[model samples]
Target: MSHHDEEIDAAGRADEFLQVFKKGAEFTQDLLKENERLRFRVVQLEETLKEKGHDTVDESPDAIELKKKIEVLEQEKEEILGQIKVVEEENQNFANRYIEIEEENNMLANLYIASYQLHSTLDFKEVLQIILEIVINLIGAEEFGVLLLDEKTNRLEPVASEGLVTSELPSVAVGEGIIGEAVHSGENYFIDSMEGYERDFEKPIVCIPLKIKEHVIGVIAIYKLFTQKDEFTNVDYELFTLLAGHAATAVFSSRMYSDSERKLSTIQGFIDLLTK
Candidate 1:
């Protein structure tokens, strides 16, 4: 080959190598720019997603309503608590009243039992005095009286008495005063705060009928001659009625024994006559 031809071939080869190196450098720069742009877009999308998620959390309606409901329920709970306190106080007062009533009932019942037992004795004077004392104790009175019916005269006689004058109602007929009505009518009478009667106008009076076999035979007079206004309760009635019934039994027994003794004496007299 010629020398000139060799030199031309060398120059052509060097130019081709430079052109290839320049194209590779430009391709590398383009690829770097595209990678930087993709990285920036991804960062922007991540920031947008974070903001959207924050807005959704802040706008939760259920959480806001729950907070409001909690506040309202707390106010209502306070109101109910006040109401419960009032109810508890009222219940305490009612329980106290119930206890008081029960105590009174027990006292009256015990009094009745003691009185009934005492009047079972056969001695007329002792029995009458014991019954009157029991009635006075139950009524809390300073004065009391008992009137017994005499079947022979159909009249009431004062068998027992406390704090009474011999002139004012010493002895009355079976159908005379308010007490007499109770004895004959077989009914009980209760009067409160009366005026202008034979005894104890300033106090309460309980008139009980002593009945045997449903027939009133005697009068039990209980005078609330001194007590506070409306102080004595109706429990006194229950006790008084029980005493009246027991007194009736005692009275009837005494009458029967007396009649039997009289008849036996008469029979003895007749035998004596026959023997003579």
Candidate 2:
């Protein structure tokens, strides 16, 4: 089955689980109320027997029948309590599962929105800003840089950065360091252990290579993550994979559009001069 279909099915199951949990909770409440009534009735019967005197009550058939009825009521109360306990446990499990599924669905919705925004713009700067926003807000990166490959220099040059000095960010040769290696091999690089990770100018925590098919175009080097973000989740990895493809296409398309506009302006200027 398709990934989207699986997500939809999971959402449906979450809704069903929630309905069952609600029903179980209502049933538990009814059981508790019935148990309270049974206890009250048992108390009334015992008080009557006490007032009648123990010896007289033991000899009476009516008192003996009352005692048997009290015993049966006590047994029924115990059974109800047991049923309530089991239902409570089942409700708790269902609630937890529903929460997990809800989180997954929310993440999927965010990814869809991000993907849409990435392709909605053709302006170069706007495209870059959207990518940066995805990395910061979605991926939870606090310090990172976007570097595009400079064909003439055969190096990756920093185009934009956050929480870092852009001028201090050095250009990397195509196959030299960690960032460069990702571009050269067209593969992502990330540290498995993020505990106590400190920012390093020479090494980044994560390096994602932006590519168009097999050709690598740029690199996103994240030095550190936000303080609250202790470790990466499955959704974070999915976002990174989405960025690698969609972000690259957006940037490449914008650059081509800008170049074409410049060429068109130059041609128009020459045609006006010839007419004059």
Candidate 3:
């Protein structure tokens, strides 16, 4: 063959070799990029598994440690929740105790006021009126009567009453009905309602004996409690004790004081007339 033709053939072979080399270089670069991307993805998966406290396929010591830490955190969270619940219950109990103390203080204040009012007057009629007022307002009694014992007949005679028909009251002997029994025993009596007593008369729910020393001179009968009160409380019992111990003494002292004052004034007037 001619030399020019041989040279053209060699150049064509060289051009083909260049194209093959370029293609191989591009394939190698693509393989390197793909390897790097796979390496980064593996790192991401390991970090995610460790953070989630999960054992990956490798099951490394770090994963095991992370799982134990997660378990501890879960237990601590439960303990914290339990502690919070306990604190809440304690707070509720404290609040309830505070309210109870406040109520007791108020009850004591009422008792003091009632006692003060009982002793503040000297008029015989006024003393009876004050006793009735205390029973109605402080003790929350709807129907009640103050009965003074007759020395000669030994029977009860009502002096003051509210919400009860005076004519309906029957004559009670010294040891007969609830009021009479309280007066005889020198103790307080209580009933829930009028279940067994006579239906003709209003049945008294409570009877308190008024006493000076050991002698019961009168009785207080409560027919029905106020609607707001369901039953008597400890404070109510305290009030009954106060009345039982002090009511008769207060009434007697006021009567004696008035009678003495009247006698002294009469004596003074007689002395002045004689001097003139």
Candidate 4:
């Protein structure tokens, strides 16, 4: 009975050892499969990094900040271009204003010179000469005449003539020709082209009336302008106004002074004779 029991026990122990060995072999096979799967996943991540053109997978914060700075710089460039255009326009305006101011100063200087020369002398003959000089030199006139109204007939007669070969000017009443019309109206009349007054004179340019207060004393007739002068500007009209108001009065004062001196000399001689 003891031998049979011992044999049965040895057989059961052998069966249990076989079962434990089988389970351990199965666990080792599963661990090998999981290691292969992890290696495949690592290879896939490396390929994705290559396709995106990056050594690492994630983008840093500094790279995003640099992109924003580039956009801001492009916007600033557009603003600077607009400012440059505005500065160019302002420079052009300043240049135009400078030219206008220079022209005004030159006109003022010319007026002052004319005024000083007209009042420098009291002699009647010298005054007539001065008037001719002003027309020929200062006014840049080629042909001109000084016509005075005769008190007896109330007709305009040329007292002085320049750049013309005629012996005497044509007779003109106070309201007849262009010169006479200005004398009667006491205002300056301007003709733009030679075609306007071609019948009266070859090229009558302007006629300025000489007035002393309310009365017109004479007229200054300008037949033709200088070759360089194309037309009369506003500066020329201002000069005409100055001459009309001042020149006539200057001539009248000189004549009155001369007549008074002659009368005084005659009375003094008579008194000396009576005393002797």
* Cα lDDT tens digits for candidate 2, 1-276: 999999999999999999999999999999999999999999999998787787787879998999999999999999999999999999999999999999999998999989899999899999999999999999999999999999999999998888888788889999988998999999989887877777776689999999889888898999988889988889998888888999999999999999999999999999999999
- Per-candidate TM-score against the hidden true structure: 0.57, 0.67, 0.68, 0.70
The TM-score leader among the candidates is 4
Candidate 3 all-Cα RMSD: 8.3
Off by over 4 Å in 4: 1-74, 165-167, 195-203, 271-276
Ordered by TM-score, highest first, the candidates read 4, 3, 2, 1
Off by over 4 Å in 3: 1-58, 165-171, 195-203, 227-230, 269-276
- Candidate 3, residues 125-184, lDDT tens digits: the string is 888889988898878888888888887999988877778876666667898867788889
Report every candidate's CA lDDT: 0.72, 0.91, 0.84, 0.78
Q: How many clashes in each structure?
A: 0, 0, 0, 0
Error of 1 at 195 (Å): 4.8
Model 1 poorest ten-residue lDDT run: 195-204
Error at 8, model 2, angstroms: 99
Per-residue error (Å), model 4, residue 266: 3.5
Q: Which stretches of candidate 1 lie over 4 Å from their true place?
A: 1-69, 72-90, 93-97, 165-168, 195-206, 222-224, 227-232, 254-276
Candidate 2 contains a number of clashing pairs equal to 0
Report the alpha-carbon TM-score of model 3 versus the true structure.
0.68
Instruction: Quote the lDDT for 73 in model 4.
Output: 92
Model 4: weakest 10-residue lDDT segment is: 195-204
Instruction: Put the candidates in lDDT order, highest first.
Output: 2, 3, 4, 1
